[model samples]
Target: MGKATGFMEYQRLQEASEAPQSRKKHYKEFVMHLDDAQAKTQAARCMDCGIPFCNNGCPVNNIIPDWNDLVYNGKLREALDTLHSTNNFPEFTGRICPAPCEAACTLGIIKDAVGIKSIEHYIIDKGWENGWVTPQPAAVSTGKKVAVVGSGPAGLAAAQQLARAGHAVTVFEKNDRAGGLLRYGIPDFKLDKNLIDQRVKQMEGEGVVFRTGVLVGKDFPAGITNWAKETVSPETLQKEFDAVIIAGGAETPRDLPVPGRELKGVHFAMEFLPQQNKVNAGDKVKDQISAAGKHVVVIGGGDTGSDCVGTSNRHGAKAVTQFELLPQPPEQENKPLVWPYWPTKLRTSSSHEEGCERDWSVATKRLEGSKGKVEKLIACRVEWKDGRMQEVPDSEFEVKADLVLLAMGFVSPVQPVLDAFGVDRDARGNARATTDGAGCYKTNADKVFAAGDMRRGQSLVVWAIREGRQCAREVDAFLMGESVLPR
Candidate 1:
């Protein structure tokens, strides 16, 4: 789809980054996007493979080849349009998505994959600079109304599509900001908050109404009150709107029930992340968690844990240690055995590079503390045997810890929220909703639907955007007897 001989002429080039020592001083984005020359060269790396597995590999199915060709030809505007055709917010995905498309690139079969994410970042940023990313309001109103619960990527995507389809769309968010995780959960160094604000402004011009600080259901867990100021029952939305979409994220964090769990200085990752984010946004955060001068121990080895590591370093923690339950994967994957599929391999994030002492196949036995405050963590090394974790004898140890952050990930959506809507849940506690069939995205309740993490469990932002777009199509069809929106 790009130059025929370009793949042989170019090598994959990553975006430049500021030194860790310098970037750790603040939370602003330190990674710079590719320039015009670099972006064009990177896009030229795309080859005309018989089949572009990269397309299917991407959850949103972005037209990678088409955009790559456009960028190589210096058609930056066209490239931006192609990128926006499938994904609503390339700015978010370009910065934070793991880029499964790059992993499945044809060039990756023999060499490094094309720099699709960086090119996307370049195109979107250029589009914004040129004032090309404007609102596309529907000309005719369908007179139907849609109430979307949540302001995360999924809810935002669905609301934008429905608004463009001539329906009045209202997004209800618990937080006082439009972007949910993008605004609160993620660190500012990885993604700037201004990008989200830009999208929210464009969506508003497109006729999407966003009501922040309005909870969609009741009995929200503790600490939720910090974000939500008012409540709107599911019945109110169902009564007022023609159709309702529940796209709330998975909020129930998995807990560590070890001894001294109730001690001070022990907290879930969400509690720690959102507070820093709020503080960055100029909001006064009372009793904000700080890793400064403290021995920080982050549990779990996924992105959440990595985020903890980065945030801790930014806070100038005395020391940062991360733990994982599973054995570490090989540094390099056997790509031939898992071509075009996401391979299990070691991934070192910028956060890890900042500074962290990481260990694998370890389990926390308990939290040791003094006088209602956490002081140390008791842990043991383990080995996997026949898919079961077996503790290694005489391997139990303890480490000093002034702060303990649990980044073990979430289990499901807040149950009471789903209960208020009378939506049936799956075995995993996710809202019961099918992505395909005659009645896709339809929940057990009439005129109600579910999508994204609330229905699919914890997943990437790309997957959430995909579900949100697909669910919008289903909702449009249900309301208008047919849908013009893309799946």
Candidate 2:
């Protein structure tokens, strides 16, 4: 610990955010990082907890205390090194991670949790500014080739690690750009696309090849979000590469199959989100779905739904409303009951702060429309008892909705890719693979491995990076009979 009494002496200070009214006018990052002195003070607040639950709390198991001490002592480069030891991409996580590590912070038991996320954001941003981030090309050639499917966080991490382990790695992306969800699915306001480009350039310098707009599968179905300009058969990869890793993420979004789901103006969050991201990147899109001057209704009160709300507000919508079928969680979690773990509580994002009418315990009965265009939503209040939901009598209501966006999360990875590889699938439709023992990350098919959302179903980016790093180690060992890559 840098300062034994630092936690007692300092109160938690969050990063400042742009005014919602002003920020909603443009699709750019509004959160401002803490200056050096403030970051040092925040880092000093890390308590001398023996267990360091935050390490376990973080999906990538970042060495929080060591970096906190280093930052507090003004050893900026040392802090960055300690950070890079566990996590491959702090810049991505620092901006988007929910910071479960802070929830598990020991100081959170009695006072506010240490601002670990802010400190990380500061450290990585400083590292980039100081030209500390650079290519770490392999020292020797292993004379092996690896193929990574998908260009999301998991695929990127796996490719980088495998390349650095002296193997030729090529990443194939179905999209026209490198980043998967980060490039399209996410709004540009939270994360700038240039950050992804910067990392991709560095990875290329480290001997990793990125093939964008290249789909590595066959029998591509229409209506599925495939941006591939060219298709490469799975057989080609199996023959050309020594090992193939499936990191193509969970792309099959869960659908709302109620009546009138076929109505026009109702779309998946993916379809709506990617268009805006593309537009932000200065790409022209035809017949783009616009929320401008429409009564927008977003279903599913999750991160995706929140993103819809933000985008809708930016488009100058007439009104925006969000719906959740589940009951609202408590405003504050019981710390004694759920300490050192992620707590369940009400979470209001910056999008909600901008403007949104949020409701819970409501389920949509059907979407009513005129001339094949959605006009309104029929909903009803419901009660959950004995694990069963029953609609409340006489609680049906209707809300005006010109455009409806379904953001109810994803169900599984796109099955065609997995099928093309002949990989077994779990009951949940993720690629079936183990994460322990001798066959960790290895799929049922020979010379093929799975990791990240493709194997674990949709999850956090940090978890995807962890799985990617671990999967790379397993793949390396499988190739060379042993590996020095960390688990």
Candidate 3:
């Protein structure tokens, strides 16, 4: 931890965010970072808890206390190494993760939690600036070959780990670029694509082969299973690679079945979000969906929905409204009861603070339209009882909606890819695989493993990286007698 009395002596300080009015003008990151002195003071607030729960709170189980101490002691490089030891992409998590580690902070019981995320943000950024982040390619090759599908954080983490374990690793991405959803789903304002490019370049230098836009099933020969539509087949992958890890994200979106659902103005949040990311990356997109000069109504109150609101504001929408079917949560949580666990309190993202009318306890009944395009959203307030939702009487309302974006979250990974590989699926429609000591990450298919969103359903980037790293260990062990890689 930090100074013994640091927790009481120093208060938590966070990076300032650009005002909503200013940020709404552009689709660029608006959060300001704390200077070294400010970050050091924040790090000093980490108390020496007997058993640090922040480590458990983090999906990747990062060495939180050690880094906080390191930063407090001005040992920046060691802190970065400890950070990278557990997290392959601290930069990504630092930017986007909700920071459950903060909630689990012992000091957070009475005061603001240690600026764990901000400290992480500081360390990685400093590491990059000082050129401390360099590829350490394995000294000797084990002559083993491994293939990872989907080039998201999970796949990248796994590929990097396996490659570092002296295995020849190749990552196959269906997209035109690496970084899977990191390159597509996330908005550039949250994560700059250049950061992804920078890490990708390092991975390349580490001897990890990346093949983009070569659909495994379609472009490559039919390998394992040919269920992949835009990528190589499972059979082909099996033939070329000694072991295969399916790390694709959950691609299928949960849909709302209602009248006029097919209206032209209505689209999945993914469809609307990715185009903007592509445009930001300097790609030419024809007829891009623009909320500019139009009323925008985003459905489903979640991270994706919040993203929609932020994007709509950037698009200069006339009005933006977000609807959530569930009842609103309390503004604060009961720490005594929910300590060391993620609490179900109302959480607002920066996107929400930017500007938008957010309403919970409401349900969408239908999409009213004209000319095959949504014109309005007809909804009603709802009441919940006995685990069911009921519409409140006489509470029906109609909101002007020129464009409707559904961000209800994903239902499961696309079945086509899993089917093509003949991998068994769990009840949640995710690739069936256990993470226990015995069969961790092992798919039913021979020499096949699964991880990330495809294996665990939709989750945070930290979890994806954790699963990726762990799965790499499992794959290595399966390929060799055992693995030196940490689980």
lDDT of 2: 0.93
Candidate 2 colliding pairs? none
User: For candidate 2, lDDT tens digit of each residue in 329-432?
Assistant: 99999999999889999999999999999999999999999999999999999999999999999999999999999999999999899999899998999998
After superposition, the stretches of candidate 1 with alpha carbons farther than 4 Å from their true spots are 223-226
For residues 323-375, write the lDDT of model 1, one tens digit per residue.
Answer: 99999999999999998899999999999998999999999999988889999
- Weakest 10 consecutive residues, lDDT, candidate 3? 220-229
Query: What is candidate 3's lDDT per residue for 1-487, written digit by digit as tens?
Result: 6688999998888788889888889888887667889988998898988889999999899999999999989999999999999999998999999999998988898888899999999899999999999997999999999999889989999999999999999999887789888888888888888889999999989999998875654332211111223556789889888999999888788888988898989988888888888788788988999999999999999988998999999989898999999999999999999987888899888888888999999899999887788899999999999999998999999999999998999888767778888999989999999999687999999889999998999998999999999999999999898999998
Which model scores highest in lDDT? 2
- TM-score of each model, in listed order: 0.99, 0.99, 0.97
Candidate 2, residue 242: how far the Cα is off, in Å: 0.2
Clashing pairs in 1: none
Native-to-model Cα distance after best TM-score fit, residue 49 in candidate 3, in Å: 1.2
Better of 2 and 3 by TM-score: 2
Task: Write down the worst ten-residue block by lDDT for model 1.
Answer: 219-228
As a whole number from 0 to 100, the lDDT of residue 351 in candidate 2 is 98
